[model samples]
Target: MNFTHPSIRAQIVSILTAWGMPKHLTDITAEIMVETDLMGVDSHGISMLMAYEEMLKLGQLRIAGEPRVVRDFAATALVDGADGLGHPAAAMGMRVAIEKARQFGIGAVGVVNSHHFGAAGYYARMASSAGLIGLVTSSTRGILMVPTRAAEPVLGTNPIAFAAPAGPGHKPVVLDMATTTVAGNKVKVYHLNDKTLPEGWVQDEGGRPVTDSRVAMDYVFKKKEGGITPVGGPEHLGGHKGYGLALMAHILGGTMVGASFSPIRNRTQKPDDPNNIGHFMMAIDPRAYRDMEEYTTDLDAVIDVLHGAAPADPAKPVLLPGEPEEMMREKRLAHGIPMPQSLIDHVRAIAGRAGVAYELKET
Candidate 1:
């Protein structure tokens, strides 16, 4: 079913409020979720409602908590999220970074003890919108992936994002991606759709390839046996590159924030046990290099050339990292966001329990 952004945001806010979230935090959470849907990242959008509801029920998230600054330097700061929703904490961090970047040539912020912060690109885009280059990375809970030549799970599906301004009438060059072949959320989406996974995406507990999404999710989430693989599948295929990147993110994010690493932290069972998931963000002023306008113009020219590059496959032309997502965002914004039938039903159930009215737009 399709739902207007405002409607979806309102529904989410109402549901969260009913679930005992503070009014202000509920608004922030709803806004972030709705924005994810608006950006066509359905996996991180309203589909996460059930997960948030479960977290709230378990008291893993405190509705009224605010983030606190633990340490500060001229161009850097560390924030303790205080177990608050990741969106608000991240937003505040980016804002602080932007302010510092304006004064200095660059600014960096590290955050810890926050919940899942929707899409990393959103935070990067925030920096780009402020006329600065933005970079972000985060370490997630123990939904580890199968390492090369390894049978069991080890590392989390860490993600990295970068965003920079382009030119007039052009979207920023925003790249956000998981280090793994496929994110756990994508596997969760497939499971929700009653579909199987591809062979390359996961492995069994014994290190054998598996195509069953249920088994994959079960192994990673329940048994802690197997996990999703890195981008290159195995070590022979340069999977070590992805592993290296994941480790880099873990160090910059987790270690810097004083959080436990994936192998040591157990967040699946104890969601509120201060898993200390960490995030890092940096913003750089474009004027530091050259004239801002000329820099963006050159960036646009390069992107245009790449977009027009000769295609290896006629059916699948070259694409910029953010182009596909930008197209999806535009299309969804015009037609309203689509939700799975089961998700719609779940939302309705929540609304019913909360005494809030529910509406689904016609297809």
Candidate 2:
């Protein structure tokens, strides 16, 4: 079923507010999540509410919590999420970083005690929209990644994102990706669609590839056994690079912010304990290096050249990092966003539990 973005956003806001989430926070969360859906990232959009609902019921996500700035410097700062939803905290972090960058040419902000924030690119785009460069990273709650040459999983997907202003006549250059071969939530997307997993996205206890989506989802989310691989398939395919990148994200988002590492936290905390996830947001002002006009003009030239390049398939044009998402947003805005019946049903169940009216009408 296809639903309009406004309908999805309204349902999200209603359910979140009904669940006792602050209206302000729900507004921010709804905007980010619906934008994610518009950008065609099905795994991070409304689909994530299922996990959030479970977290809330288990006492892991606090609806009344608010973000507080804990530490501050001229160009750097830290925020405590107060064991709350990550959206508000992350949005604040990016906004703070953007302000600091405007003043100091660069800014770095970190958030601790946060729960799952949706697409990292949303925060990055906040900076880019302000005519600055942005970078974002976050430590994930689930231990879903099997590091290179590891027998069992040790790391989470640990996503990273970067965005830079593309100036006029071009979209921002944005790149958002999980360090793992595929994000763990993508398994849920496949399960919802009743689709099989592509090889190398997951592996079995014996380290062999698993393509059965149901089995893969069970291992990654439920059983928590042999799981997803690093960005590259394995050691032979340069997966070690991805493993190292995940740690880099962990270092900045988790270790730097003093957030709990899920592997270690699982051993020490109860199942319902707060995930204590962390986020890293940074922004750089191009004006610090050169005039905005010069920077943007050069960037536009580079993008133009890239777009002008010959395509391997003539039917498909050469596209930049964020063009596909922009295209998707345009398409979804014109038509309605597609929602699987299963996802719609699940969300309706959550709304029922929250005592909110189900308002996701088919478009």
Candidate 3:
């Protein structure tokens, strides 16, 4: 089924407002979700409504709360998310960092007490839109991945993203990826899409590989056992690098931000207690380093050369880091966004539970 972006966003806003989320926050959340869907990141799109709804019901997520600044500095700061949805806090942090970067060469913001914040690239793109380099990363609460040489899941699928503004006629260079071989939520997307999971993407609780998407979803979300593998499958293939990256994200987003780790904190069982996830955002101003025009012109040359390179397959053109997503966004904007019937059903279920109107059309 294909749905108009405006229609989806409107329904989301209505549902969120009815569920007690402030109007401004709901608008932000809806924009992020719709933008994510337009970029073809189905895992972070409307499909996540169910998870957010569940988090709200459990009282782990809230709205209309102000983020408390824990540390204030010129180029660096930390903010407590006030146990709310991660979108608003992360977005605000990026804005603050951009403000600082306008004067300073770089700025960084750390956020704690946040919940899942959809796609990290969204925040990075925010900085890129402001003509600055951007970095966004987040750490989750529970053990969600099997580390190298480990028999059990002991790390979250910590994610990292970076975006840099490009010169005229070029799209920003945006890269977003999970430390794990694949993001856990992607398994849910695959299941709903009726697609098969590839090998080495997931493992059983006891460290065995599993290729079925449905089974992987159960292991990760149901807390049954083993979960995602590191960026590399096993020790020989560079799984250690992925494991190290996960820890690096945990250190910045989890440790430095004062968020609770799955292995360290047990405050999640009760309703109203926060999951205490954390996020990190950094922005860099190109003009602070050199002349902005010169830097951008050089970047455009680099993109030109990249595009001129010979393709391994003539039918498929070589693409830059963010080109595919840009193409997807363009395509989606013209033709309506595609939604799996299963996802539409799930979104309707969320609306039903919230007692809000579902104003969507499927064809």
> Which candidate number maximizes lDDT?
2
Residues 20-120 of candidate 2 have per-residue lDDT tens digits of 88888999999999999999999999999999988988988887799989999999999999999899999999999999999999999999999999999
Error of 2 at 66 (Å): 0.7
What is the lDDT of every predicted structure here?
0.80, 0.92, 0.86
Clashing pairs in 3: 205-226
What are the models' TM-scores?
Answer: 0.93, 0.98, 0.96
Alpha carbon deviation, residue 105, candidate 1 (Å): 1.2
Task: Write the number of the candidate with greater lDDT, choosing between 1 and 2.
Answer: 2
| Model 2: lowest-lDDT 10 consecutive positions | 232-241
Model 1 superposed RMSD (Cα): 2.2
Global lDDT of model 2: 0.92
Query: Mind giving the per-residue lDDT tens digits that candidate 3 earns over 1-363?
Result: 789889989888888888888887888888998999999998988888888888787877776566767787989989888888888888888988898898788989999989888899999999999999999888986577787788887889899999999888788999988889888889899899888888888888677777787777888784687788889776656688888888999899889988888766764366667788999999999998899999999998988899899999999998988778889999988888898889889988888888987888643
Tell me the tens digit of each residue's lDDT in model 1 across 1-363. Answer: 677887888788877777677787777778878878887777787878777766766787775668878889999998888886687778778888888899998999999888788888888988999999999988887666666677777888888889998898878898988888877787777776778888878777777777787777776564757787887876646577777778788888788877668676663547456456788989999887789989998999998899899999989988988878888878888888887777788888878877788855544
Error of 2 at 293 (Å): 1.1
Question: Candidate 3: lDDT of 337?
Answer: 89
**Decoy 1 TM-score against native:** 0.93
Q: How far is candidate 3 from the true structure (C-alpha RMSD, Å)?
A: 1.6
